[model samples]
Target: MNKKVAIIGGGIVGASAAYYLSTLPGGDQINVTLYDDGVGQATSAAAGIISPWLSKRRNQQWYQLAKDGATTLMTLARRANLSTDVYHQTGTIVTRTNEKDLHDLYVLAQERREDAPDMGEIKQLDEQQVKQRMPFLTRSQPGIFISGGARVDGAALVEKLLAQAQQVNLIVKRERVKLDDHGKVITSMGPQRFDQVIIAAGPWINELLKPMGINVDVRPQKGQLLELSIPDFPNQENMPVMMPEGERDIIPFGQGKLIVGATHDDEGQFDLSITPEATQDLMTSAQAFVDSLSADNIIRSKVGTRAYTSDFAPFFGRLQSHPHLLVASGLGASGLTTGPLIGRLLAGTLIYGGTPDWSNYEKPLSTYLS
Candidate 1:
């Protein structure tokens, strides 16, 4: 018998899960329908950074998840025939303002390189080398360059996934879904019964599960970002992503275009308005690294709300209270890097029912329910 599966949410996590579920082995036997209300989608707002080595977090679980996520993105890029402009392996330059900070970054880089050999050519760049490689950077601070670091276009990736999913007979509906107690999915068109439902809503998962008396510890993390265009900057496309050991990053988007951003604010609201304070802060931080982006060069600012968990880890697996419901969310800032893997993990569990090794991922809400 064919199992009818309904996926709530259309962000990266949900989209990736839907794509994998509709194409994985034995997936053809499953009928999939994806419901997206098109509200609070963090995937499109994501910075799409894929540099796991730059993170100083030494937790094995987090590291493994990020590593697998990066690997999965590469595999998907190739499999999906995504253009190079959309996904760039442009590498990353991790910099620090002071000598002590630079030294600390070097030590962490050494440790990370030794632990993950596949990171590929983790080396320190002198001030001159940094300038030569990334001329847009104004400061002469020492930086660490990782060859494998890359960036992605989150919005483009989602579109590709949706197209592929539809190609494989997965139904895409832009409707808000409500789940009744009996596992009936309520949509605008009508109520539909599904054998299973997966909640991949980024920050709105809590609202969807509230009727079921389930509250996953997900908070809205507002990240305000800036998009800039540095016109006539020589060889800007080849310049790598620059990080200043802060909450901000400068990502190059080819053709002298740059994305400087992300002010982390936890106001717990869906307000997409950019605060003047955040814009100034981001611009000030970005200017310290890249001199060209003056006040006048500012293109525009945008906002994205990420699903942040209490433990700062993603939730994956079936909810024990509701056996037919599975969830994957709370990816925080690492969603672009880890969302794909989370989807694959959930899809694998659904396709093959057995004791699976989920040690590397986050604990599901079921762990707390019991």
Candidate 2:
């Protein structure tokens, strides 16, 4: 008999899992059912930019995972015959407005050792050099570092991956999941049994799995983002720029529109209301880097919550008590950058009998449940 796998959540993480699961050896013998309440409306939708360099400081293991994830997405796009326009290869520019933060950035750049292959040497850019590379930047800051990175349209990537998974016979279900006493998964729309279950649900995973004795300390970190439709706003040269103010990032996605974002609030709230204060804060911080960004040019704005782990790292690997259950959550703000690699690791461990060294990756479930 073939083994069946039930995946909860249809966002990037879950969708990536289904995609990779279909590619493994004897993968055709496995059946994958992906469950989601709202199709990519959570952290996946809120992902502004995907960059390996920005996430490099997290640690070497995470950096490798993120890099692999990005590479996998690019490979998938080519194989699927999809347009590569969704992924912008323009590198990011990390600018410093405050001297203190500038010093810290230099220290971080210096501390990167030779063994870290992913974090290549950070190249310092002068005002003219920065403008030469990314003319959209106003160059109001004194110091800027150009790091090799890439950006992806998070929403588009999710849709593309989901569509590709469907092509491979992966069942996609749009419904919430509930687990039984024996740790069996129960979906709101359908009743199905599986040999294995993976919970890649973002912010709602904790609540959905609590009754099954799987208490994930994942909290919702809300982020508010805005899009601008200024036609004259700089073109493709507009690279991803991060400002010291509120640690906001200004990302350009090719066209006249730009993605200005992200306020991190630990209140664990799920309301998508765009507050006046957040809107003003985003506009103020955005203007610091991109001088042309004004409130009047704003086309759309919304809020979304990302799932944050206690250690700020993702939760991967199988559950100790319930060996059949696996998890890949707590991606926080790096879901788009890390989802593919983590999904590959999770699927490899579960279906292929491979072992994943979770020493660097957060294993909160093992620590608490074991």
lDDT of each: 0.79, 0.69
Largest TM-score belongs to which candidate? 1
- Superposed Cα deviation of residue 190, candidate 1 (Å): 2.4
TM-score of 1: 0.93
Give one digit per residue, the lDDT tens place, for model 2 in 1-370: 7788988887778877888788767678887888877733564556445555443364566666666666676566566565545665565667665778767766765564243344444766555776665566674454445354556666677777778777775888777778876778876645568899988878787776777766777778777888876554455634544434345777766677677777777773676677888889888876776777677889888677788767676767787777888877778778877887778778777777755576664544564332
Q: Provide the lDDT at 33 for model 2.
A: 81
Q: Any runs in candidate 1 off by more than 4 Å, and if so which?
A: 367-370
lDDT of 1 by residue, 1-370 (tens): 8888999988888888888987789898888999986766788876667888768775668778988788888787887788866677788888876878777877887787776665677778888998888776677567888887888878788888888988875899988888776656888877888888888988887877777877678788888888877764776776778776764888888776788877778883577787888889888888877776677887887777888777787778887677888887788889888988888888888888665768765554554333
For candidate 1, the C-alpha RMSD (Å) to the true structure equals: 2.0
